[model samples]
Target: MHREKALDAGLHPEKIRVEADPYVPIAAARREILEGIVTQLRARGRVPRVCRYALAVGGQEPRHSLDAAAAFAVRQSWRIGVGQSYTDHHGAAESLTRPGWCLVRQQIRAGYADGVVVVTHSVVSPHIDAYKQQLNWFGAHFGFVALVVPEMQEWRP
Candidate 1:
């Protein structure tokens, strides 16, 4: 559908490669988030500091998604010392409240990362209120901010 729209809009297929999957968007979002993080850090007077990353996405195939996200983060000059993905088949709460999040939090508290990069806000919850609440909770408890790529916003601690 998107490829067809691009073609209809006079975009040459040879000039664009389109994949009918979520990975492409996820990867793009990852790059954008990492770059945004770098900019934010620089603005805060942090000079060329290596950033460790934790990747959490909610889906059946989180491994593939996290791999793509991590690759893009590395390309964007993120160190990515820690990375993890969770399958949200059971529920967003189940995944969000699990050990993975705790481990990520631990890493941040231990001075491993400046913040976490979430692929999308929906990874926390589909509902807007829940998403914001969870972001706030993580920020408050972990003392680290989250960059929600899809929303292009940072949920601060």
Candidate 2:
């Protein structure tokens, strides 16, 4: 009904893609296309113009984690932007009140990166809602989160 109404109202048919709606509760076609691009990038090697982000929560050492994330980026064929790596030691807040996180947002805002590579989603947030919120924020900024370690069987696809 709504689709017919939209067409009757002079909306272009191509402009009303129901499957592309974010609130549709299904994997959007656009997302599938993006995943395909990521896969192609991996096949080629060294996808340029990405960034790295790490959170050293609960007193975990940051260097090793960052290196691992960097390796993950390489394996995914992403070339992280120079000086675009960010880190936050204490990850105990939902508000994301950390200097390094703030910097990452800045980089995202400035359109310098497509997304960030992280060790895990838990580095973004331990709670589910908070984790989703962070991802949503990244989406809002036209960026995304790439996890090196998928906790359990949770993969990006």
**TM-scores for every predicted model:** 0.47, 0.64
For model 1 the local lDDT of residue 70 reads 61
Candidate 1 regions off by >4 Å? Answer: 1-40, 43-61, 82-96, 137-149, 152-157
Candidate 2 minimal-lDDT segment of 10 residues: 21-30
lDDT of 2 by residue, 80-123 (tens): 87797887776446537877777877887897776777776667
- Give the Å shift of residue 38 in candidate 2: 4.2
Mind giving the per-residue lDDT tens digits that candidate 1 earns over 1-157?
7668877668554565554533344435444554565687678876322322333345445555466556655655555553333233425353356565656566656756655555565554555555555555544543333343655343423
Each model's lDDT: 0.50, 0.66
Candidate 2 whole-model C-alpha lDDT, 0 to 1: 0.66
Clashing residue pairs in candidate 2 (N, C-alpha, C atoms within 3 angstroms): 47-77
lDDT at 7, model 1: 70
**Highest TM-score model number:** 2
